[model samples]
Target: MSDVLVAVETVSRAKQLKAATGALHEALDARMMGADLFSSRDRYALFLAMQRRLHAGIAPLYGEPALAALVPDLPGRAKLVEIDRDFADIGATPPADEPVFVDPKDVPAALGWLYVAEGSSLGAAFLLKAAEALGLSVEHGARHLAAHPEGRGLHWRRFTQALDAVELTEAEEARAEAAAVVAFRRVSRIAEETLAGA
Candidate 1:
Protein backbone atom coordinates (compact mmCIF):
# COMPACT_ATOMS: atom_id res chain seq x y z
CA MET A 1 0.00 0.00 0.00
CA SER A 2 2.93 2.33 0.56
CA ASP A 3 4.95 4.04 -2.17
CA VAL A 4 7.49 1.22 -2.25
CA LEU A 5 5.05 -1.29 -3.76
CA VAL A 6 5.41 -1.48 -7.49
CA ALA A 7 3.28 -3.03 -10.21
CA VAL A 8 2.87 -6.39 -8.55
CA GLU A 9 1.72 -8.05 -11.73
CA THR A 10 4.87 -7.02 -13.52
CA VAL A 11 7.30 -8.69 -11.13
CA SER A 12 7.49 -12.01 -9.35
CA ARG A 13 5.56 -12.01 -6.08
CA ALA A 14 8.84 -12.72 -4.32
CA LYS A 15 10.39 -9.54 -5.66
CA GLN A 16 7.28 -7.60 -4.86
CA LEU A 17 7.66 -8.78 -1.31
CA LYS A 18 11.38 -7.98 -1.21
CA ALA A 19 10.80 -4.51 -2.62
CA ALA A 20 7.97 -3.81 -0.22
CA THR A 21 9.98 -4.82 2.81
CA GLY A 22 13.47 -3.67 1.86
CA ALA A 23 13.51 -0.80 4.33
CA LEU A 24 12.08 -2.88 7.13
CA HIS A 25 14.57 -5.67 6.47
CA GLU A 26 17.47 -3.22 6.54
CA ALA A 27 16.30 -1.84 9.86
CA LEU A 28 15.77 -5.29 11.32
CA ASP A 29 19.21 -6.45 10.17
CA ALA A 30 20.86 -3.38 11.64
CA ARG A 31 19.07 -3.87 14.94
CA MET A 32 20.09 -7.53 15.09
CA MET A 33 23.70 -6.70 14.18
CA GLY A 34 23.93 -4.20 17.04
CA ALA A 35 22.63 -6.86 19.40
CA ASP A 36 25.97 -8.78 19.17
CA LEU A 37 24.03 -11.97 18.78
CA PHE A 38 26.99 -14.36 18.68
CA SER A 39 29.69 -12.76 20.80
CA SER A 40 29.09 -15.48 23.44
CA ARG A 41 26.68 -18.20 24.46
CA ASP A 42 24.64 -15.84 26.63
CA ARG A 43 24.03 -13.50 23.70
CA TYR A 44 23.44 -16.41 21.35
CA ALA A 45 20.82 -17.73 23.73
CA LEU A 46 18.88 -14.54 23.21
CA PHE A 47 19.02 -15.16 19.49
CA LEU A 48 17.73 -18.69 19.99
CA ALA A 49 14.93 -17.43 22.19
CA MET A 50 13.63 -15.26 19.40
CA GLN A 51 14.22 -17.97 16.87
CA ARG A 52 12.19 -20.33 19.03
CA ARG A 53 9.33 -17.91 19.20
CA LEU A 54 9.46 -17.28 15.46
CA HIS A 55 9.72 -20.94 14.51
CA ALA A 56 6.87 -21.86 16.80
CA GLY A 57 4.82 -18.98 15.54
CA ILE A 58 5.10 -20.02 11.93
CA ALA A 59 5.35 -23.80 12.24
CA PRO A 60 1.68 -24.26 11.52
CA LEU A 61 1.79 -22.23 8.38
CA TYR A 62 3.68 -25.04 6.77
CA GLY A 63 0.59 -27.20 7.18
CA GLU A 64 -2.24 -24.78 6.60
CA PRO A 65 -4.35 -26.29 3.83
CA ALA A 66 -4.42 -23.20 1.67
CA LEU A 67 -0.72 -22.52 2.04
CA ALA A 68 0.23 -26.15 1.64
CA ALA A 69 -1.75 -26.25 -1.57
CA LEU A 70 0.55 -23.49 -2.76
CA VAL A 71 3.77 -24.91 -1.37
CA PRO A 72 3.57 -28.66 -1.46
CA ASP A 73 6.86 -29.30 0.31
CA LEU A 74 6.03 -26.70 2.94
CA PRO A 75 5.22 -29.16 5.69
CA GLY A 76 8.69 -30.66 5.59
CA ARG A 77 10.42 -27.36 6.31
CA ALA A 78 9.55 -26.77 9.96
CA LYS A 79 12.41 -26.19 12.41
CA LEU A 80 10.71 -26.00 15.80
CA VAL A 81 12.00 -29.40 16.82
CA GLU A 82 15.51 -28.37 15.89
CA ILE A 83 15.22 -25.21 17.98
CA ASP A 84 14.10 -27.28 20.92
CA ARG A 85 17.11 -29.56 20.48
CA ASP A 86 19.36 -26.52 20.45
CA PHE A 87 17.87 -25.49 23.79
CA ALA A 88 18.36 -28.97 25.24
CA ASP A 89 21.94 -29.13 23.98
CA ILE A 90 22.70 -25.97 25.96
CA GLY A 91 20.61 -27.07 28.98
CA ALA A 92 18.32 -24.10 28.67
CA THR A 93 14.57 -24.23 29.23
CA PRO A 94 12.95 -23.14 26.03
CA PRO A 95 10.47 -20.30 26.07
CA ALA A 96 6.91 -20.75 24.88
CA ASP A 97 4.33 -18.73 22.99
CA GLU A 98 1.40 -19.11 20.60
CA PRO A 99 1.80 -18.70 16.89
CA VAL A 100 2.27 -15.09 15.79
CA PHE A 101 -0.47 -15.40 13.18
CA VAL A 102 -2.98 -17.62 14.89
CA ASP A 103 -5.36 -19.09 12.32
CA PRO A 104 -5.16 -15.89 10.33
CA LYS A 105 -8.44 -15.07 8.61
CA ASP A 106 -6.61 -13.43 5.77
CA VAL A 107 -4.98 -16.10 3.67
CA PRO A 108 -3.19 -13.55 1.54
CA ALA A 109 -1.84 -11.78 4.58
CA ALA A 110 -0.94 -15.15 6.07
CA LEU A 111 1.12 -15.87 3.00
CA GLY A 112 3.00 -12.64 3.63
CA TRP A 113 3.96 -13.71 7.12
CA LEU A 114 4.83 -17.16 5.85
CA TYR A 115 7.06 -15.50 3.29
CA VAL A 116 9.04 -13.86 6.09
CA ALA A 117 9.40 -17.18 7.87
CA GLU A 118 10.57 -19.10 4.82
CA GLY A 119 12.71 -16.20 3.67
CA SER A 120 14.66 -16.30 6.93
CA SER A 121 16.02 -19.68 5.87
CA LEU A 122 17.66 -18.00 2.93
CA GLY A 123 19.85 -16.05 5.37
CA ALA A 124 20.51 -18.93 7.75
CA ALA A 125 23.71 -19.95 6.01
CA PHE A 126 25.41 -16.85 7.36
CA LEU A 127 23.79 -17.17 10.75
CA LEU A 128 24.79 -20.82 10.98
CA LYS A 129 28.40 -19.82 10.30
CA ALA A 130 28.22 -17.26 13.07
CA ALA A 131 26.83 -19.92 15.39
CA GLU A 132 29.77 -22.15 14.54
CA ALA A 133 32.07 -19.42 15.84
CA LEU A 134 30.37 -19.87 19.21
CA GLY A 135 31.26 -23.56 19.16
CA LEU A 136 27.84 -24.52 17.92
CA SER A 137 27.10 -26.88 15.06
CA VAL A 138 24.14 -28.34 13.18
CA GLU A 139 24.15 -31.35 15.48
CA HIS A 140 24.51 -29.19 18.53
CA GLY A 141 23.05 -25.72 19.08
CA ALA A 142 22.61 -24.66 15.48
CA ARG A 143 20.39 -27.33 14.02
CA HIS A 144 17.67 -24.87 13.17
CA LEU A 145 20.09 -22.85 11.11
CA ALA A 146 21.34 -25.76 9.05
CA ALA A 147 20.53 -25.74 5.37
CA HIS A 148 17.67 -27.91 4.20
CA PRO A 149 18.69 -31.40 3.11
CA GLU A 150 17.78 -30.23 -0.38
CA GLY A 151 19.99 -27.17 0.24
CA ARG A 152 19.01 -23.56 0.76
CA GLY A 153 19.28 -22.53 -2.87
CA LEU A 154 17.14 -25.36 -4.21
CA HIS A 155 14.72 -25.14 -1.32
CA TRP A 156 14.25 -21.41 -1.72
CA ARG A 157 13.83 -21.84 -5.44
CA ARG A 158 10.99 -24.32 -4.93
CA PHE A 159 9.34 -21.96 -2.46
CA THR A 160 9.64 -18.88 -4.65
CA GLN A 161 8.44 -20.77 -7.66
CA ALA A 162 5.32 -21.69 -5.74
CA LEU A 163 4.89 -18.13 -4.48
CA ASP A 164 5.48 -16.38 -7.78
CA ALA A 165 2.95 -18.62 -9.48
CA VAL A 166 0.08 -17.28 -7.47
CA GLU A 167 -2.33 -14.83 -9.09
CA LEU A 168 -3.57 -12.24 -6.64
CA THR A 169 -5.61 -9.09 -6.93
CA GLU A 170 -4.20 -5.63 -6.34
CA ALA A 171 -5.77 -5.38 -2.91
CA GLU A 172 -4.56 -8.87 -1.98
CA GLU A 173 -1.08 -7.92 -3.09
CA ALA A 174 -1.19 -4.86 -0.87
CA ARG A 175 -2.31 -6.94 2.06
CA ALA A 176 0.50 -9.43 1.52
CA GLU A 177 3.06 -6.64 1.47
CA ALA A 178 1.61 -5.07 4.61
CA ALA A 179 1.63 -8.41 6.39
CA ALA A 180 5.30 -8.96 5.56
CA VAL A 181 6.19 -5.56 7.03
CA VAL A 182 4.26 -6.46 10.15
CA ALA A 183 6.07 -9.82 10.42
CA PHE A 184 9.52 -8.24 10.11
CA ARG A 185 8.61 -5.56 12.62
CA ARG A 186 7.55 -8.29 15.05
CA VAL A 187 10.94 -9.98 14.69
CA SER A 188 12.64 -6.65 15.29
CA ARG A 189 10.60 -6.06 18.42
CA ILE A 190 11.27 -9.56 19.75
CA ALA A 191 15.01 -9.26 19.11
CA GLU A 192 15.17 -5.84 20.69
CA GLU A 193 13.36 -6.98 23.81
CA THR A 194 15.32 -10.21 24.17
CA LEU A 195 18.73 -8.68 23.39
CA ALA A 196 18.18 -5.81 25.81
CA GLY A 197 19.09 -8.24 28.57
CA ALA A 198 21.97 -9.87 26.68
Candidate 2:
Protein backbone atom coordinates (compact mmCIF):
# COMPACT_ATOMS: atom_id res chain seq x y z
CA MET A 1 0.00 0.00 0.00
CA SER A 2 2.78 2.40 0.99
CA ASP A 3 4.72 1.50 -2.15
CA VAL A 4 1.71 2.26 -4.34
CA LEU A 5 1.87 5.89 -3.20
CA VAL A 6 5.44 6.30 -4.36
CA ALA A 7 4.28 6.96 -7.92
CA VAL A 8 1.18 8.93 -6.92
CA GLU A 9 1.41 12.69 -7.08
CA THR A 10 -1.29 14.91 -5.69
CA VAL A 11 -0.27 18.15 -7.39
CA SER A 12 0.47 17.02 -10.92
CA ARG A 13 -2.72 16.17 -12.81
CA ALA A 14 -0.83 14.00 -15.28
CA LYS A 15 0.44 11.72 -12.54
CA GLN A 16 -3.04 11.48 -11.10
CA LEU A 17 -4.45 10.45 -14.49
CA LYS A 18 -1.79 7.81 -14.92
CA ALA A 19 -2.32 6.46 -11.43
CA ALA A 20 -6.09 6.39 -11.83
CA THR A 21 -5.81 4.62 -15.15
CA GLY A 22 -3.37 2.08 -13.69
CA ALA A 23 -5.63 1.37 -10.72
CA LEU A 24 -8.62 0.86 -12.99
CA HIS A 25 -6.67 -1.51 -15.21
CA GLU A 26 -5.44 -3.49 -12.21
CA ALA A 27 -8.96 -3.96 -10.84
CA LEU A 28 -10.33 -5.03 -14.21
CA ASP A 29 -7.51 -7.54 -14.60
CA ALA A 30 -8.19 -9.31 -11.32
CA ARG A 31 -9.83 -12.75 -11.38
CA MET A 32 -13.31 -12.09 -10.00
CA MET A 33 -15.49 -14.96 -11.26
CA GLY A 34 -15.66 -18.37 -12.88
CA ALA A 35 -18.33 -20.22 -14.93
CA ASP A 36 -20.30 -21.84 -12.10
CA LEU A 37 -18.81 -19.80 -9.26
CA PHE A 38 -20.93 -16.70 -9.86
CA SER A 39 -23.90 -15.67 -11.95
CA SER A 40 -23.35 -13.45 -15.00
CA ARG A 41 -25.68 -10.89 -13.48
CA ASP A 42 -23.53 -10.66 -10.34
CA ARG A 43 -20.34 -10.28 -12.35
CA TYR A 44 -21.80 -7.65 -14.66
CA ALA A 45 -23.09 -5.71 -11.64
CA LEU A 46 -19.58 -5.58 -10.18
CA PHE A 47 -18.07 -4.55 -13.50
CA LEU A 48 -20.58 -1.72 -13.92
CA ALA A 49 -19.81 -0.43 -10.45
CA MET A 50 -16.09 -0.42 -11.16
CA GLN A 51 -16.59 1.29 -14.53
CA ARG A 52 -18.64 4.03 -12.93
CA ARG A 53 -16.05 4.86 -10.28
CA LEU A 54 -13.20 4.89 -12.78
CA HIS A 55 -15.12 7.17 -15.11
CA ALA A 56 -16.07 9.42 -12.22
CA GLY A 57 -12.51 9.88 -11.01
CA ILE A 58 -10.90 10.45 -14.38
CA ALA A 59 -13.67 12.57 -15.87
CA PRO A 60 -12.75 15.82 -14.14
CA LEU A 61 -9.06 15.30 -14.79
CA TYR A 62 -9.63 14.83 -18.49
CA GLY A 63 -12.56 17.17 -18.98
CA GLU A 64 -11.74 20.00 -16.57
CA PRO A 65 -10.43 23.44 -17.54
CA ALA A 66 -6.92 23.83 -16.11
CA LEU A 67 -5.55 20.31 -15.84
CA ALA A 68 -6.50 19.14 -19.31
CA ALA A 69 -4.83 22.22 -20.76
CA LEU A 70 -1.58 21.38 -19.04
CA VAL A 71 -1.28 17.73 -19.95
CA PRO A 72 -0.51 16.79 -23.55
CA ASP A 73 -3.82 15.86 -25.15
CA LEU A 74 -3.10 12.98 -27.50
CA PRO A 75 -1.23 10.53 -25.22
CA GLY A 76 -3.81 10.70 -22.46
CA ARG A 77 -6.63 10.16 -24.91
CA ALA A 78 -4.74 7.31 -26.52
CA LYS A 79 -4.34 5.59 -23.20
CA LEU A 80 -8.02 6.07 -22.47
CA VAL A 81 -8.93 4.57 -25.83
CA GLU A 82 -6.68 1.61 -25.11
CA ILE A 83 -8.43 0.99 -21.80
CA ASP A 84 -11.84 1.31 -23.42
CA ARG A 85 -10.96 -1.23 -26.07
CA ASP A 86 -9.68 -3.64 -23.42
CA PHE A 87 -12.90 -3.33 -21.49
CA ALA A 88 -14.90 -4.09 -24.60
CA ASP A 89 -12.79 -7.17 -25.16
CA ILE A 90 -13.42 -8.28 -21.61
CA GLY A 91 -17.16 -7.71 -21.85
CA ALA A 92 -17.50 -9.51 -25.16
CA THR A 93 -19.68 -12.59 -25.00
CA PRO A 94 -17.92 -15.93 -24.93
CA PRO A 95 -18.68 -18.36 -27.76
CA ALA A 96 -22.22 -19.72 -27.59
CA ASP A 97 -21.25 -22.96 -29.33
CA GLU A 98 -18.88 -24.12 -26.63
CA PRO A 99 -19.76 -26.05 -23.52
CA VAL A 100 -20.45 -23.68 -20.65
CA PHE A 101 -19.50 -26.14 -17.94
CA VAL A 102 -17.02 -28.94 -17.65
CA ASP A 103 -15.97 -30.66 -14.42
CA PRO A 104 -17.66 -28.91 -11.47
CA LYS A 105 -14.42 -28.85 -9.55
CA ASP A 106 -12.71 -27.11 -12.47
CA VAL A 107 -15.18 -24.24 -12.61
CA PRO A 108 -12.95 -22.05 -10.51
CA ALA A 109 -10.07 -22.86 -12.80
CA ALA A 110 -12.16 -21.99 -15.85
CA LEU A 111 -13.24 -18.67 -14.35
CA GLY A 112 -9.68 -17.85 -13.47
CA TRP A 113 -8.69 -18.65 -17.02
CA LEU A 114 -11.28 -16.28 -18.44
CA TYR A 115 -10.13 -13.52 -16.12
CA VAL A 116 -6.52 -14.02 -17.07
CA ALA A 117 -7.41 -14.04 -20.75
CA GLU A 118 -9.65 -10.99 -20.64
CA GLY A 119 -8.05 -9.07 -17.80
CA SER A 120 -4.42 -9.92 -18.29
CA SER A 121 -4.34 -8.79 -21.94
CA LEU A 122 -5.20 -5.22 -21.06
CA GLY A 123 -3.93 -5.10 -17.48
CA ALA A 124 -0.43 -6.14 -18.44
CA ALA A 125 -0.45 -3.74 -21.37
CA PHE A 126 -1.44 -0.75 -19.22
CA LEU A 127 1.03 -1.49 -16.43
CA LEU A 128 3.86 -2.09 -18.81
CA LYS A 129 3.09 1.14 -20.62
CA ALA A 130 2.94 3.05 -17.34
CA ALA A 131 6.22 1.53 -16.21
CA GLU A 132 7.83 2.57 -19.48
CA ALA A 133 6.46 6.13 -19.26
CA LEU A 134 8.05 6.44 -15.81
CA GLY A 135 11.31 4.81 -17.02
CA LEU A 136 11.04 1.96 -14.54
CA SER A 137 13.00 -1.11 -15.70
CA VAL A 138 11.42 -3.64 -13.37
CA GLU A 139 9.81 -6.50 -15.30
CA HIS A 140 6.48 -7.93 -14.18
CA GLY A 141 4.37 -10.85 -15.31
CA ALA A 142 1.81 -13.27 -13.83
CA ARG A 143 0.68 -16.83 -14.47
CA HIS A 144 -2.60 -18.51 -13.48
CA LEU A 145 -2.56 -22.26 -12.94
CA ALA A 146 -4.42 -24.91 -11.05
CA ALA A 147 -3.32 -24.61 -7.46
CA HIS A 148 -4.76 -24.60 -3.97
CA PRO A 149 -3.94 -21.85 -1.49
CA GLU A 150 -2.93 -24.30 1.24
CA GLY A 151 -1.47 -26.85 -1.15
CA ARG A 152 1.58 -26.72 -3.46
CA GLY A 153 2.46 -23.48 -5.18
CA LEU A 154 3.72 -22.97 -8.74
CA HIS A 155 7.18 -24.22 -9.57
CA TRP A 156 9.08 -21.00 -9.12
CA ARG A 157 12.40 -22.49 -10.14
CA ARG A 158 11.09 -23.75 -13.45
CA PHE A 159 9.17 -20.54 -14.11
CA THR A 160 12.24 -18.45 -13.39
CA GLN A 161 14.23 -20.58 -15.76
CA ALA A 162 11.90 -19.82 -18.69
CA LEU A 163 11.87 -16.10 -17.89
CA ASP A 164 15.62 -16.15 -17.61
CA ALA A 165 15.85 -17.63 -21.06
CA VAL A 166 13.77 -14.79 -22.46
CA GLU A 167 15.69 -12.17 -20.52
CA LEU A 168 18.99 -13.54 -21.75
CA THR A 169 17.98 -13.24 -25.39
CA GLU A 170 16.50 -9.77 -25.13
CA ALA A 171 18.97 -6.98 -25.95
CA GLU A 172 17.34 -4.45 -23.68
CA GLU A 173 15.60 -5.07 -20.39
CA ALA A 174 11.94 -4.23 -20.79
CA ARG A 175 9.05 -4.88 -18.44
CA ALA A 176 6.61 -4.48 -21.31
CA GLU A 177 8.17 -7.27 -23.33
CA ALA A 178 7.71 -9.78 -20.55
CA ALA A 179 4.18 -8.61 -19.90
CA ALA A 180 3.20 -8.71 -23.59
CA VAL A 181 4.58 -12.22 -23.91
CA VAL A 182 2.54 -13.38 -20.96
CA ALA A 183 -0.61 -11.70 -22.28
CA PHE A 184 -0.17 -13.13 -25.77
CA ARG A 185 0.35 -16.60 -24.33
CA ARG A 186 -2.77 -16.40 -22.20
CA VAL A 187 -5.03 -15.18 -24.99
CA SER A 188 -3.55 -17.58 -27.48
CA ARG A 189 -4.09 -20.62 -25.28
CA ILE A 190 -7.71 -19.68 -24.64
CA ALA A 191 -8.45 -19.18 -28.36
CA GLU A 192 -6.38 -22.09 -29.65
CA GLU A 193 -9.25 -24.32 -30.69
CA THR A 194 -10.75 -21.65 -32.92
CA LEU A 195 -7.34 -20.70 -34.21
CA ALA A 196 -6.46 -24.29 -35.07
CA GLY A 197 -9.71 -24.89 -36.90
CA ALA A 198 -9.23 -21.76 -38.97
Best by TM-score: 1
Cα RMSDs, all models: 5.5, 21.0
As a TM-score, model 2 comes out at: 0.23
> Highest lDDT, which number?
1
Give every collision pair in model 2.
Answer: 34-111
lDDT of 2 at 12: 30
Query: What TM-score against the true fold does each predicted structure earn?
Result: 0.90, 0.23
Could you tell me which 10 consecutive residues in candidate 1 have the lowest summed lDDT?
A: 97-106
Candidate 1 — what's its lDDT? Answer: 0.85
lDDT of 1 by residue, 61-179 (tens): 77788888888887888888989999999888787774566465467887898789888899999898999998999999999899988889999999999988877898998988899
Locate the minimum summed-lDDT window of 10 residues in model 2: 139-148
| Model 1: how far residue 85 lies from native, Å | 1.0
Residue 93 error for model 2, in Å?
20
lDDT of 2 by residue, 1-198 (tens): 455535663333212223334543344334332221123333432332333333322333344333223222312321233333433434533232222222212222221222223233233333344333433222211111112233222332222232233222222222323333333343334333332432
